[model samples]
Target chain A: MSARDAVLGAVKAALGRSRPADPADPAAVAAEALALLADPDAVRPALPGTDAAVAFAARVVSPKVGATLDRVEALADLPGAVRRYLDGQGLPHLLALQPDPALQGLDWAGFELRDAALPDEAAAFGLARWGIAETGSLVFHSGPDTAVLGHFLPLHHIAAVRASTILPHLEDYAAVCGAAPRNANLITGASGTTDIEGSYVRGAHGPRFLHVLLVAD
Target chain B: MGTVFKRDVARALSDATLKTAIDRTTVTAERKRAAALTDYPQFAAARERGTRIKDHVVAHLDHYLLEFERNATASGATVHWAADSEEACRIVLGICRGAGARRVTRSKSMLGEEIGLPHALEAAGIERVETDLAEHIVQLAGETPSHIIWPALHKTREQVSALFKASHRDPHKTEDVEAMVESARRELRDRFLSAEVGISGANFLVADSGAVCTVTNEGNAELTTTPPRVHIVTAGIEKLVPSLAHAFVLLRLLVRSATGADLTQYTTFHCGPKRPGDLDGPQEFHIVLVDNGRSRMLADAGLREMLRCIRCGACMNHCVVYRQIGGHAYGATYPGPMGAVLTPALQGAEKARDLPHACTLNGRCQEVCPVGIPLPALLRGWRDRSWKDGLVPQSVRSGLWLWRFAAERPRLYHLGTAAAVRAMRLFRRGGWIGRMPLAGAWTRYRDFPAPAGRTFMEQLRDRERGR
Candidate 1:
């Protein structure tokens, strides 16, 4: 018998399930698992009673993750928000941006923007596919427009999260992530490590500063 | 793996450096975990949900495992099954050899340690690099991990500096934490960029979408899973959850219980190998699900609850014995209260008979356990089994038998206790017993308390009679 058969058979014999179901029958197994997934009785935490954008902004600036948050009234105001955030942090006005159409039409008056790769010690910007308000994490799906490298490999990371896309809990966000992107990163804040003498130090191997721009309609 | 608990604990206690390191780190971790839970108002509900989800999954494990395999295969990844550690190691080595991988980079994986993967790979001439900062320090020191979450919690800054100085080319590096972290970042960056294969342990294996979720604060797991051509995920069969929603429920409690963080810095999900338009990711993805004595645990109802562990390491942090003796004393891949029950269950009661007796019956581990495992009860069950199997020491067995004989009858019990108290009074120095014959082990450290003028029953009877 195969290793899979031996392992599954052992589990069945241990469970003492009088008659074991065939594991090779994908349709029956999938149907059972899909029923659980389709309507999961998940325990969702009580979200903040404030607006979605307000909750997202508050959590993003919380001490746990330590990411700065900026709310803009419209997509047209994104460039100003990014410029002001960079100037406030005393960062240079150069960035590497993912090739998303939502970010393309922005007027780059005083900034030097590049594509495909993150520049050395520079900031990078990407659009978040969704925002989880409970943890203030920005969910980014890897695709042609959203470069996975742009999420990491930079000293500073700035993500644009539309207020409309902010979900109250992780269960709500799970609904939006059902399509199964090739790679999805739910980055809570800047990279940190407490490995050395149990001290919290930012920028272990990823971006040191994470700035979120909350774009409101 | 044998019963060397006494010798191992003696060595750990003498190491003043390890004691100080564990003292400082566990205190901070315990405080942070408490504070993080306070910040989240719904932590209790989340923990309950996590326990229920795990219990449900373990009940129907075969279906979920098959579901995960089918979905992962559909997403262009290969899934392998291993009934034991040897098969798991063989499959991992086979994958590396097939990929022509000479140098492999890995994140911190407790499962990897459980199966002794590093030794197997090294024996086969594959260079394995541990990318986690704590793991890297332990690897360089040629020591096993002393703590589960914080592997290098047993090392001092001076020790870490010495290890790094010896391993790396930085001869003049100072003994500063930031400088040490920067040096490791610089050194491991090259390994991540050039490694042929990357191996990581999954925090959760989602059956719905065939994703392997990894939570890390240092972002090393992300780098390890990325950049390499072949990414291999080695996880135990108990890691399966039915859906992403169920996974989120456990993830919410895991970070708080482990590090007191609202969420880790990175919770990346690797759904499968690189998709059609992906720019940079692993071209091939493989997941190795290893049983390694888990099915045996699942068979016995008394020990089945041990499989509910999420590898959070909270039980160890709150354990009184563990805080004093540290993880090295356990002499196993796992340690502390969870290890006390799980070590024997996984590696039979006969081989690890002393592990169950290592505890003080303190229920602090059960109190702080996120999954609500009755650890003390399980340890007591193991002790009972060992006694039945005659695996206990002869002295212990005889002492218990003598106590049982005297206690079964009221007259004999009263007379036995009265005579023992009178004899103890003879040897009392001032108010404490400074030394005793049969209890040299107990009296060697400190004085045993002397009995009062009368036993409790005599005092009670005198008070009731108005004497």
Candidate 2:
């Protein structure tokens, strides 16, 4: 028997089942999975009001999460907001722009931009599909348009989140993303570590800063 | 007591630096966890919800494991099953060899440490770099991880600086944390870009979504798995949750309990390798389901509750005994209250007989446990089993027998207790015992106060006569 058979057999034996699963009937396992997921909402934690985008912003910029936010009035103003953030932080105009239509399609003038983030790039921009109020998380889906490195390669990761996409709780993330993408990256704040001497050091490997461009629809 | 654990504890106690590190980190972590929980009152309900999900998953392990296999396979990922650590290592090594990988990068995987994956890769002539800062520090120093969450929790900043100096051969600043972190990033940035394979431990395996969810504070897990050609996730069979929704419940509680943070900086749900037109991601994705001793744990209903552990390290943080000796004294892949029960359960009762005795039976670990595993009760159960298996040392067994003999005879019990109190008083100076025989372990850390030189019966009789 294969290792799979032995493992499943061991589990079956522990559960007091008579035999290993039939090789041909693979759907039986999928059926079992669907049954368990049937009540996915059976258990949920209480959350803030559904219209708590302001609360979400509060949590995001809290000292513990340590992320800064910028709210824009329209999609067209995103580039200007990014530029404003860069100028405020004393960063340069050169930044890596994620190769997505929603971002790349924007008319980015006056700023030197690369299609994808370079290893040594100082800043990069991407779009979050949803914002979680419970944890102040940005949900990004990975696909042909979404370059996974755009989130990790740069020192400063600038994300554009639609104000209308904010959800009250973390559970809303699965409902929105649906687990269909290749990967769902839910980042809560700037990267940090206390591994050296139990002292917090920001920007360990990922970006030191996560500045959000909360665009109002 | 297990001889190995006893000697390890004795050796660990002398390292004053280890004690200080453990004291500071555990206190800080516990305070942060408390503060984080207070900030989110729903955390109380969330932990209960997490327990419900995990309990269901553990009861129906076979169904979810098979379901996970089917969905992952459909998503263009391969799922391998390993009944033991050796099998797990062989499968990972086979993947590396198939990719013709010369260098590999791995994130912090307690399962990897349990299965000795890094050593297996090294013995195969592969250069494996641990991407997590704590992991890198220990790997560079040629040492095993001292803590599950913080591997180099025992090492001081100077020690880490020394280790980096020896390995990187750089004059990185010793006092500045950022300079040291920057040095590591500079050295590892190229390795992450060039490595052929990346290995990570799964925080949760979603059967419905066919995703392996990983939680990281530093985002090293994403960098480790994303940039490589082959991404291998080795997780225990018990890591499975039914769907992403259930995983969210546990994720909220886990981050708060572990780091005292609202959420980890990065929590990525990876469903497959790379999609058909993805610009960047590992081309090959594999999930190895390991069942080293979990099947046995499942077979025993009483022991099965432990499979619900999220590896939060909260139990260890609150454990008084863990605060003193730290993780190394347990001398196992896991340590503290969780390790005391888990080491013997996974390995055997005879192999780690001393571990169960190491805990003080305080209910703090269980109180703080997110999954509510009844850790003290489990340790006590192990102690009872140790007695029956004759795993308890002969000296302890004889001592218990003598105490039981006197207890059955009430007259002798009173006489024996009265004599012992008088003898204890002889060693007292200023109402405190400077030294006590056969209780050296108790007094070694603190002074023992002298008891009144009388039994409870004598004291009661005198009080009644005076009245």
Candidate 3:
């Protein structure tokens, strides 16, 4: 086939046709695009603030959310808040997986703890640093100090997220990386499988419930 | 030659049952993700971090993967290296056989799909059950995944209900998602407990601690990894990060990009086999690292960035064409922008010649990509490669030559444009073109709005004289 025929064939395959007019007026196309943007269903709308985000979360995550997974603005002492929450839960026998230096001097006396140790089969909790976030997800990276099983092997998981480390768009994340890395994952949520007849099951290979400890110092 | 991808996609789209199923499922995920990412400034930064970490990792992949192997082995976890899909499959199967595993539960892993591992396992008298909600549907129906995030999006509730009735021990006919979920949960719970071995894919493998990270919304990955005596993690070679701190950088970008989640309900990390002090964990842990064609991707600077992808499927979700055509059309394990570049590059030019050119060259995929891969540039590169390799039809080369000739001469270009305008005007009816000779396929479903008289340049010239 001639090059023209090849291009046409490819175009035909793409459009399922022979020849497509490559639009006439560029400005008119832009105008049409702008008009399409007006439709609520056409383009994604701009993000709302804390209240709006909470409302959206309520709609999607749970309509009857009580308190444990509540939304709060960036806190000054996030690690402390996490410690306090764990203390209140009456379960502070934690096996911290990948705690950062930012959490160096937090005091937890009355509770038996394994700070950044290998996840024991009986570890109450496996704490690790998250690599990504979206819709309240805490990502975990596997390595020597932290076992891939650490995040899942433990009954409870607490992820320490620095508030400053968030992005609005996936494309923005791509821009930051610029190229493929040796290893990385963009986790939106915890380990889940819908393998059984499309049923959504949580904590299949990892944790059953995920709690994000947003630490902003 | 059969345009395998085109044929499959056409079959899928034409199948009303599949189209409805896909549309319903993808629409829901798209909306939920939009809501989750909205109003979160941190999401933007996380995505940037994810991109940067992957870029750095890919640039120094040999260093990182070797580092990971050393660290993971030190942690008492066996790490097997595979240079290609075949090697990867062999290594995994060998481990399964060594452990004397008969049945295995798997969380959703696209890499597994790419290598066709399940079929290979089944041939060896091993039953591999897909434990992901969407994956189960496709596996039951004996169909390929229609979308990246929501594999069974192409199936309707009614169809799923029927499938559940046949498959579930006690199935209900209700369309209620909760009821359906409960039914599936009960069935899978048994499989999770009974299975001797579990297989999973890693989102990232941290080198510092010898950990494998699997992130999901359903929590099936945890069950697949634990409970079972032996847990096997199969991941691409590129899924290695330097440290846990580095893993954090990528997490911020992955979840929001994949499903717009701040954090999935279960983001578990697994280090190795169950320790002596552990209660209920796998006794044997093995990680199978599959290189496939990633090494080739890493060697080339222009295409290496594609490896940084977190497999979030954001590009596919946001793509106008993909949203319309769906995943099966790509005819590869991957089905969107990333697939278009990666599949052809990994598999070869002959297998996926149509994929690269089957796009509108829109920048939406690039716009939403979490790892900053220049998809259009990469797609164009594939097209160039296909042409050079003689994979493209003779007609295409001739067309390009003619177009190039016309482009170099102002007179021919203007004349051609004028002719096009005239031809388009002839097809006008009711302010739109219902059907045209060559572009019949597009007009079959959607009408093309007719252009105003004269081209933009012509109008501009006229305006210069105050028309």
Clashing pairs in 1: none
Score chain B of each candidate by TM-score: 0.96, 0.97, 0.95
Predicted candidate 1 versus true structure: per-residue lDDT over A20-96, tens digit per residue: 66343456645554554443333445567768767888889989679988889988898899899889989889888
Candidate 1 C-alpha lDDT tens digits along B205-317: 98878889999888888788878999999999999998787788788788888999978889988888988777778999999999989999999888888888998889998
Structural similarity to truth (TM-score) of each candidate: 0.94, 0.96, 0.72
Docking category for candidate 2? Answer: medium
CA lDDT, every model vs. true structure: 0.84, 0.85, 0.64
Every model: Cα RMSD to truth:
2.7, 2.5, 13.1
Worst 10 residues of 1 chain A by lDDT: A35-44
Q: DockQ for each of the predicted structures, in order?
A: 0.54, 0.56, 0.08
RMSD of 2: 2.5
Q: Can you tell me the CAPRI class of model 3?
A: incorrect
- State how far residue A130 of model 1 sits from its true place (Å): 1.3
What interface RMSD do all candidates show, one decimal each? 2.6, 3.0, 13.3
Candidate 2's residue-wise lDDT over A44-144, tens digit each?
43444546688688878988678999899888888999999999989989988877788777779989988778887899998888998878899888888
Best by lDDT: 2
